[model samples]
Target chain A: MLKVNDINVYYGNIHAIKGVSFEVNEGEIVTLIGANGAGKSTILKTISGLLRSTTGSIEFLGHNISNTPPHKIVSQSLAHVPEGRRIFLQMTVQENLEMGAFTQDGSKLRQDLDDVYKQFPRLNERQRQIAGTLSGGEQQMLAIGRALMSHPKLLMLDEPSMGLAPILVEQIFDIIKALRDNGTTILLVEQNAQMALSIADRAYVLETGKIILSGTGQDLIQSDEIRKAYLGG
Target chain B: MVFLSYLISGISLGSVYAMIALGYTMVYGIAKMLNFAHGDVIMVGGYVSLIAMTSWGLPVWAAVVVAMVACTVLGVVIEGLAYRPLRSAPSLAVLITAIGVSYFLQNSAQLIFSPNPKSYPVIINGSLSLFGGKLTISYISLVTFLVCVIIMIALTLFTSRSKMGKAMRAVSEDKGAAQLMGINVNRTISMTFAIGSALAAVAGVFLCSSYTTLMPTTGSMPGIKAFTAAVFGGIGSIPGAFLGGLLLGIIEAMAKAYISTNISNAIVFAVLIVVLLVRPAGLLGKYVPEKV
Candidate 1:
């Protein structure tokens, strides 16, 4: 489980995340849904150790990782797939996945590679192809597959469906659900509220750097305020 | 026959420059720093190997090893002390700091070794007869070319096949994402510096041995040329550095022989400008669009 308590993040003079707090329980899919600049990605970045929190703390499985470097935090079994699918463009698909397993010894590396390939068959087909040449959807799959290579305890995905087609988005959501069912905890950040809330066990609605609503996914999806604000009802 | 001889000698000189250029390209690719002090590392390597041979009475092979080790350590120390702290600083600031380091190395060498040039003992002696002894290639030139080729092949294999190599490529692509993958970015950068500096040391030994002279500023001319070669080959591309160094050396040799010795440097830069104008990304470099 991951616990975030009152973390504030800033970009020089601008306050980006204001006292945002959330928790992701084990074996569940938790989602943060909001419009642009809602501090969802900032929260994830802070937890992943890419950015520091000016106030409060983040605890991953009872360990305080607020001050840890990003690489060290990853060794603790937390994987973050940043927004924009930051896969190594020049490297081959297999190489990118290998990079994802950077913390692991060669022992389970082959098994891990097989597991990732099984999840994304397209990646297996293009294992030797350069990542930048892949389609947007494939790149997203590659990003997810790369993150899964680390065998993370908790996986954080930022805007995995941002540029994806509706059909591909559904497929990605199904994959997320399957991953949770298979015992991986997921913290998803999304702009697609309807799709996110449909799969997430619990959901938080963020607006302008603050969490405005929190409830079970179904409740939020059915709530009049969320429906009007995010569901386009 | 004369032209062929000049071409052979050019290749030998180019091999040395290519070795130094590889160091520049690799460091620039991963660390995003020009490492102006890199040339100075070559100078230091020359000094280290000279002292090891003359003062410490070490064999040529042992001296080369000592030079390599010394340069590697110095590189790591330079990264730790000078470049690491400026990781987040602007590129201009890092560039200035690198210049400062370069000057420091050169000045330190001058203070220690004095400004006068010293004779460098021959490490590789003898020559190979070509076309019935009418044309002969020195053993050192052939050895330098052979060593450069071997190192290039080895480096290519290491970067493509190793886990650390994957981490390095990842870091170069995206530092934040690379960390998310659990790569120690700082450690990768340090390793890059170490490898690059060690290569520079190899080049330094070969250069000093061939020229038979050593000076504190000896590394500057080749350093600038190798830097130019890196840029000409497409700054971050490995093969680009190799081709660039070789081509630059060949061009310089041809110009000195045919065009006039005094204007060879000018002609090298002129070729760089023309090639860059034609292909902004350098010979083997790909144009990468900046990500938002």
Candidate 2:
């Protein structure tokens, strides 16, 4: 489980995340849904140690990782797939996955690679191909697969479906659900409210760097205010 | 026969340049900074080796090891003290700092060793006759060329096949994402500097051996020339650096031999300018568009 308490983040003069607090329980898919600049990605970045919180703490599985460096945080078994699919473009697919397992011992690396390949068969097919040449959807899959290579305790995805087609988005969501069913905790951030709500166990609505509402996914989906404001009803 | 001799010597010189250029390219690739102090590291290596041989009475092999170890430590110290703090600073600031480090090394060498040039001991003596003595190849030239080739091949394999190598490539691509993958970016960078500086030391020994002279400023000319080679071959590409160094060396040799020795440096610069005009990314470099 991950616990984030009253975290404030800033980008120089601009206050990006204001007193945001949330929690992700074990064995559940928690999602943060908001429009552009809603501080969803900022919250994730803060938890992943890319950006420091001005106040409060982030506890991952009971360990305070608030001041830990980004690389050290990854060793704690938390994997973050950043907003953009920042895969190593010049490296081959297999090499990118190997990089993902940077903290693991050599003995587990082969098994982890096999597991990732099983999840994303396309990656297996293009193991030797350069990542830059991958299609957008394939790149997203590669990003997810790369994150999974670390055998993370909690997997955080930012905009995994941002640039994909609707069909591919559905496939990705299905994969996320499959990952959850297989015992991985996921904290997903997305602008796609409908798709996110359909799969999320619990969801938080964010607006202007604050959490405006929190409820079970089904309750938010059926709420008139949520439907009108976010669901395009 | 004269042409043959010139070609052989040209290749030998090219091999030396190629070794130094690899150092530049590898450091630039990982750290995204031009280590102007790299050339000065080579100068230090030559001094250390000389002292280890003459003053310490060490054997040739032990002296070479001493030079390499000294350069490697100096490189790591330089990174830790000078470059690490400026990781987040502007490129211009870092560039100026690197130049400062270069000047510091050169001045320090001058203070310690004095400004006079010193002769390096001959490690490889004698020559091999080829084509009935029409083409004579020095033992040092053969050794230099063989060593350069072996190092290049080993480096290529290490980068492609090793886990640390994968981490390095990842860090170069995206520092943030590489961290997300659990790679210690700082450590990878330190390794890169160590390897690069060690290579420079090797090149320095071979260079001093061939030229038979050592001074505080000896590394500057070769350093600048090797840098030109790196840019000409595509700044971050490994094979590109080797090709660039070899090409520059051959061109310089040909110009000095056939045309005029006085204008050889000018000719090398001309080739770099022409190559840049024709292919801005160099021969093996791919053009990367700036992302918004």
Candidate 3:
């Protein structure tokens, strides 16, 4: 479970996330759907300790990780698959997986590798191939598989479907659903509200750094305002 | 026979440059910043080794170890104190800070050692005479060549296989993503400088030994050339550093022998400019297309 309360983040003088608050219960695919510049990525970054919240706090599985460093926050079983699938392009798929286990010794690394490979067999096939050469779908798979390498309690995914073909996007969404079914709590941020809401257990609609609406997946999908605004009628 | 001798000498000088250039390239690959102070760390290593041998009355082996440990500490300290704060600053700010560190080390050495040129001790003495003494190879040159080769092989393995090595490569490509994957970016960078500085100690020893003169500014010229070698061979490639160093060394030797010794340095740099114009990425470096 993760709890974010009234967190405000800034980039120099520009206010980014302004007093935004949200939560994700255990075993829920909690989706944050918003347009560009809605501070979705910034909120995820702040939770992962890549950027600091100027006020308020973030709690993850009982730890007040508000001020923890990014690297340390990772060891706490919270893996963030950053926006744009930032896999180490020069590295092999296997090497990228190994990097996900960076905060750990090799005790469970072999097993974790097996788990990731099982999840994304395309990644296993291209284990030794350079990651940058992977197809958009495979790269997205690599990114998710890499996050799973840490055996994370909470997996935060940002724009997992960005720059992918429609079919690949469906495949990625299916993978996300499968991951949640396997009992990994996912906090997914997406501009693809229709697909996200279809799979999400609960959802929040964000606009201009504020949460404008919250409901169960089906409620938001069928909501008139949501269909008009996010779902494009 | 004359050509062979110059070639042998050239290889020896090239080996030394390769060692120094390794430090330069390794730091660049990981930290994505040029630590101009890297060469000065080598100067400090030379001083430490010289003092350990001449003043502390230590054996050659002990002195070498002392110098390496001292330089390692110095490297880590420099990264922590000088470069760490500028992590988020612009690259130009980091470059200026690196130059500042270089000057700081040089002036500190000048004040401590009085800026006088001192004779470097002969660590590897004697020579091998071959082809009926037509080709004479110094023991130090052989050692330098072997050491350079070993370092190259070891570094290749390190970057490719080891966890820390993997972390370095990851950080080099993308720092933010590396952090997301739980790699300690700061610690990885510090380790890079530490390894680089330790190698600088060895390079300093070999450089001062052949050049035969140790001074506060001794590392500056060789440092520049080795930096040139890194760029010549491709700044981030390990093999590139070795090849660049060797080529630069050979060119310097050939120029000094056949061309004007006074203009040998100029010739080496001129070659670099021409090479850059032809291949901006250096001999082994990849041309990274500009991302708009």
Candidate 4:
């Protein structure tokens, strides 16, 4: 559903992502696991068109969206839940969700909001509460819920599990699995390689802005290098 | 009696400033750009209304409607041409561009409209007495005050209840995330400029009607005052700007009555310095954490 090909991202002459490439087929959960400063988030940002790549291209469902404006990317069925829970702090939980479905038409918007509400009933309970006041776990759910409002075919989450408790992390992984089961392709970037590998169909390990390892999740988990380097086994 | 008269007039003037200040708050809240040309937009709006009513021979209502439409279009154009390209530029660059736009608009007005002030033909001629001999408010003042209050109510409802307003708030909070949610950041920013410029138009007309004079440079003082109001109220908070406007207006009037007109601005700024020293975020603004 999405392909990022040999993209080079520069932040004022610093090559953040050096020729990184990856793909996610429809309905698959593909994760990029790396340590801090490994450029996992930059790759996700480039795919979403938030950052322009000096070289290489991004294709979404067979269309070149590499240079497309960030706003237009969502219309093409790609939504990005950024690194932090960057929820509109002043807005209510319901308002955040409404903002997510900003591109949808009347009936589809209503249905989408309902679907998101169903996925996270806790959001429905706190519909009128300000998002900033919500707990870290709740804000994470709202962030994911807001992205789901776009009804995207592929959702790119940058470290959704970051700062979340281990128990909450497990539940979040379950939600990721459920989302994939329901036909939504996902590109998840995570520091928790073990948890991500458990749910991912395929996985890639990044180092210094380059993809260093690739395998099926279970296979990578069983690999000696992956176990030692990422899984902390 | 004289004191009460000045107070009433000050309230009327303050109301108009509050109306225009909302525009500043709205655009600044979302874009974090001051829209320095906003004041000049108000001046152009006055001329637009003047030409419509005088040269085009339209009725007062028709002229107001035309002026508002024209200014809204002008605002959208300015945002497109001046702001859209520099959306991601550094905050300093945006501020400089805004001042550039401000000067550009003021000079353009000078070229098209005469430099000398022109009087707005009387639309309301009567005055009503209140508080026995203490107060007498002009029909124009009453009308301007009522209109400002109405616009404030409408704006409050729009931000709180309307979907587009919520989209605006969302964009102001996080443009990148807002784009990811399918909210058109550019469009929303354009709309904020449009709405803000439109309200400034209304203020222009009221200001001209109240003072009976319009000039190319008319926007400067009010623009500064409105900017002060925005800062006083807390830059991004709507109600804060409104209260700031009213407070500044009242203080200025009281100073003119008891002290002198020369020191009114100085007093206001001094107040601002003191207020900001105590609450750096202004009255309604809260300190937000920076992104890591």
Candidate 5:
């Protein structure tokens, strides 16, 4: 489980995430749905240590890892798949996966690599292909596969569905569900409310850098405001 | 026979420039900072070697070892003290700092070593006749050529195969993402500067030996030439820098033989300009895809 308590993040003078707090339990897909500029990505970045919170605590598996450096955070069993599929474009797909496994050593890397390839067989087929040439869907799969290479306890995905075709988006959502079913805890930040609610166990609605709603995914999906604003009623 | 000798001589000199260029290219690839002080770092290496060999009465090898270690430490410290604080600042700020470091080093050397050109003790002063031409390749020149090639080979292997190298490449591609992956971005950047400075130090020592004279500003000409080589090869491409160095050296030699030495630098710059006009990115540097 991960607990983020009243975190404030600033970019220069602008307060990006204003005292936002959230919790994610074990083996659950928790989606943070928000509009553009709502600081959803900022929250995820702060938790992952790419951007530190001005004042707040992020406890991962009961360890106060708030001040830990970004790279060390991954070794602590938290993997952050960034907003853009920031794959090493020049690198082959296999090399990108190897990079994800940077924090681990010994035989554990081989096992984790095998597991990731098994989860995404498409990656196995094109393992030697340059990552930049991969389609949007394949790149997303590669990013997620890279994160899984770390054997991460909690996988934080920022907009995995971004820029994909409808079919690929559906496939991505399905993979997210399958990952949770296979016992990987996930924190998904998405603007696509309907698909997110359909798969997420718990969901929080964010508006203007604040969490406005939280409930079981099904309950939120059926809510009047959610149906009107996000679900296209 | 003279042409062959010239070509051999060109390649040897080219190799040295290429080695130093690798340092510039590597540091630029990761941090995107030009580190104008990089040249000064090499100059400092020459002085360090001078002091160790002449003042401290150390052996040639011992002098080199001490100079290299000192350069590495200085490189890392500059990265920490000067470049580190300006990380998030504009590239202009970093560029200014680099110039500041260069000036600081030059003046400090003037104060420490004085403005006189001191002869570096001849590590290898003898010459040999080869290929029917009366060629006198200095002992230090051969060593410089061999060392450059060896370092280039080792660097290629390290960047491709080692974990730290992979971390460096990752940072080059995307620093923010690399950090999220749990890489110590700042430390990696520092390591890059250290490696670059150390290589520059070796180049400085050999260069001084070839010229048999050390001045406070000896790094300028070679530094500019090496930077040109890096740009010619492709600013971020390793092998590109090597090819560019060799090409520049050969061209300079040909220009000196057939044309005027005064216009040699002008001709080289003109060639670089033409290359840029044709392909904005250097020969090996590919166009980075615009982030969506």
Candidate 6:
């Protein structure tokens, strides 16, 4: 389980995230849905310790990870696949996954790597190929696959579907659902509200850095305001 | 026969430059910043080794070990104190800070050891007679080439096979993504500095010993030349730096022998300029277009 307690984040004089809070229990897909610049990624970054939150704390499982460095956060079973898929462009696909298991003591990654390869055989096929040359969809799969290499208890994915094709987007969503079904907690941040809400156990709508609505997946999908504002109904 | 001697000597000199360029290229590769003070670390290593031998009465091997330890500590300290704070600052600011660190090290060396040139004792002696002594190879030159080759091979292995080495390569390619992978980026950068400084120590010893004159500024010209070699090879490419340094050394040695010693440096720079004009990215460098 993870908890974000009323955190506020700032960039210089500008307040980016204001009094935002949320929680995710074990074995659930909790998504934060919003348009561009709605502070969804900022909140995920804050929780992962990539960005500083001036006024609140983030607790992962039981430890207070508000002050933990991003690298330390991953060791505590929290993996963040950042925006743009940020895979090491010049490295081989296999090496990218190996880097994912860096904190897990490099030798113990055989089983973890096998599990990831089983999930995404495309990555396995291109194991020796450089990651940058991969297609947008393949890169997204590699990004998720790299995160999964860490054997995380809770995975935080920022914009997993961005720049992906519709068919590939569906595949990614299926993978997210499968991950959750396998008992891996996921906090997904997405602009694709329809796809995210379809798989999410619970969803939160953020606007201008504050949460505006919260409900179960089906409830939000059927909500007229949600359909109009996010689903484009 | 004269050309052969010059070529051999050029390779000998190039081994030192290649060694120094390893430090430059690796730090540039991983940290994404040019630590100009890297050259001064070589000077510090020279001084440490000099003191260990002349004042402390240590053997040449012990002196090398001592200098390596000293330079490694100094490299980590320099990264911690000078470069780490500028991690997020503009590259221009870091560049200026590096120049400042270079001047600081030079001046500190002058103050501590005096600016006068010191005579460096011969660490490697004797020469092999070949072609009835018409062609000769000094022990130092042979040792320099051998040591440089071993270091290069070792470093290549380190960055390729080891876990920390893999972390270093990942950090070099993408720092933020590397962090997300649970690698301590700062520690990796620090390790980069440490390894670079250790190589610098070896280079410093070989350089001073080969020239037989040690000064506060001994490392500067070679440092500049080694930096040039790094760029010539492609700034962040390891093999590029090695090949560049060797090429640069050969060219400088040839120019000095066939032409005039006074204009050898000018010729070296001229070649560098021409190479850059043709390749844009150093000999081995790849051009990455900036994303708008």
Report backbone clashes per prediction: 0, 0, 0, 1, 3, 0
lDDT of 1 by residue, A27-118 (tens): 99999999988899999999999999999999999999999999998889999999998999999999999988888888998999999999
Q: lDDT scores for all predictions? A: 0.93, 0.92, 0.93, 0.87, 0.87, 0.93
**Recovery fraction of native interface contacts for candidate 3:** 0.96
Give TM-scores of the second chain, every candidate: 0.98, 0.98, 0.98, 0.95, 0.95, 0.98
Model 5 lDDT per residue over A1-233, tens place: 99999998898888888888889999999999988999999899898887889888999999998998888999988999999879888788888888898878846877887888888999999889999989999999999998887888899999999999999999999898888888989999999989899888999999877889999999999999999988889
- Note the residue pairs that clash in candidate 6: none
What's the distance in Å from true for residue B200, model 1? Answer: 0.8
lDDT of 1 at A86: 94
**What residue runs in model 2 are displaced by over 4 Å at the alpha carbon?**
none
A217 Cα displacement, candidate 2 (Å): 0.9
- The TM-score each candidate achieves on chain A is 0.98, 0.99, 0.98, 0.97, 0.97, 0.98
lDDT score of residue A2 within candidate 1: 95
Error of 6 at B58 (Å): 1.6
lDDT of 3 at A26: 93
DockQ of each: 0.90, 0.92, 0.92, 0.82, 0.78, 0.89
- Residue pairs in steric clash, candidate 2? none
Clashing residue pairs, backbone N/CA/C < 3 A, model 5: A70-B182, A71-B182, A71-B183
Angstrom error of the Cα, residue B272, model 4: value is: 2.5
Residue B14, model 6: lDDT of: 93
Q: Which sections of candidate 5 miss by over 4 Å?
A: B132-138
Interface RMSD of 3: 0.7
Where's the lowest-lDDT run of ten residues in candidate 3 chain B? B283-292
Error of 2 at B27 (Å): 0.5
Model 4, runs deviating above 4 Å:
A108-110, B1-3, B131-134, B289-292
Better of 1 and 4 by DockQ: 1
